[model samples]
Target: METIVPDSEGRGLLARLPGRVRDLVQLARLDRPIGAWLLFWPGAWAIALAGRAIARWDLILWFGLGAVAMRGAGCVYNDIVDRDLDRRVARTAARPLASGRLSLKMAWGWLLTLSLVGLIVLLQLERTAQIMALASIAPVAAYPFMKRITWWPQAWLGIVFSWAALVGWPAVTGTVSAPALWLYAGSILWVIGYDTIYALQDIEDDALAGVKSSARALGDHARGGVAGFYLGATLLWGIALWQVRPEPLALAGLLPMAAHLLWQVAGLRREDPADALARFRSNRFAGLLMFLACFVVGTAT
Candidate 1:
């Protein structure tokens, strides 16, 4: 019984599209918009917390578009590089490239097409933002191979995924500030937490394949690992908030988002892949909650 479609990442009508179209959609993980949201929010938060988000709505929108395009490009690039490894991982075995539905040549072509979309978004930003965006390339390119060598590949992912914060701040402020740096650091921990949860889905497969991940590193304490990461994130976020407003009360802004992260830790079930994914996807809302907190604090009198 040969599986023809990538069931792990694609679903609903998107999964039912014509074979060619569906393959393209799933290749970019368009069916899972949570990745886009997760990528977009850190930039959005940086903008909102920089105090001109309402006025600079256009930058926010451009960053959102950039997230979509770049994330797609990243997925395509990763798939092309990891096609062989992917075939051995159950959840990724049916990816278009791994399943033989799409050739590596076509995958590279798709990656360039998506990168063009990202380039268009880059042109909308100032030189500083453009440079910041370009700087992310090396880390992004290295990410697919991190698992082959490191127990903390998620840490590398943290650096790659949280990069939008660097771009977002300079796009508006015209310079990277302390608050933005703190926010990016916090986002790194946040990414580590959620992505570790995501990696739980492939623990056995990753083990069989001899790949490494934070989830495997944490072992029986995976839940506690996530909790520790989330706690570090909260502390960094709180520090970022305080740097912006310098008011002790501004720290309270993190309460809702912090509580949400805590709830994720409390509800974690390492044995259940569905539960792990649910926890991972829940970061979309966690991102929103943090954005609101930043907006409220950043806009305060």
Candidate 2:
């Protein structure tokens, strides 16, 4: 019987499940929902920014569901691909596949099951949105190998995770526009910033395993690197807001989120794994702040 891993977020609930079920749940990362929330926000921002959120509320629901399923599938695939490397990282070593609690066949079955749920969500979108969503497959397939090839794998993750903005805009408006593009671009920066913080938790292990990440690349300058990425995200999001509503007050929508990102960067304890994990998790709230900004600017008269 496999016990809960150290990084699991829902240990109480996970503990009640049968051993195999618990392993599957952990394999899909269902125990930790921060990733799903992070994955969902870009699409939510896009829908709200497109000014059709209230009317197209269904898209939000669908995207939210899709985020959970697809993020899970992505995690399963990443685990399958990195199972060897995962064993080399203490934080990741106990993951189902890496720890030998789950077999490759079981992991593949879970991946397909999660992907089936994703397919259901994808079928709910309009043609344009569906096409846009399908286009993400190549990037998604390429992401697990990124750390092996580049220090900027977080950038590839940014690309993969921020793809919902492309689909959401088209889902709402039946066409992609400048606002969506800017939102996607800004979201990529945001992902890189937060994910760098996430990578801080595994810096030493990643180095020992020969894995590269922005956190390792930044070294002592990681805080500044995160600050730079956050700053760029804010500027791009401001530009996106301006594109939607050119009035001065429109840019004010970003103030709260900007302040939040600043707080994260200003107080970040780069060397503490706990602080790094806390800062990374706080992006869930940061994401909501940006969504509110997008909502206000997008829905304003």
Could you tell me how far off, in angstroms, the CA of residue 265 lies in candidate 1 after the best superposition? 0.3
Clash count, predicted structure 1: 0
Query: lDDT of candidate 1 vs native?
Result: 0.89
Highest-lDDT candidate = 2
**Steric clashes per prediction:** 0, 0
Against the unseen true structure, what C-alpha lDDT does each candidate score? 0.89, 0.92
Q: Which stretches of candidate 1 lie over 4 Å from their true place?
A: 1-10
Q: Give per-residue lDDT, candidate 2, residue 161.
A: 93
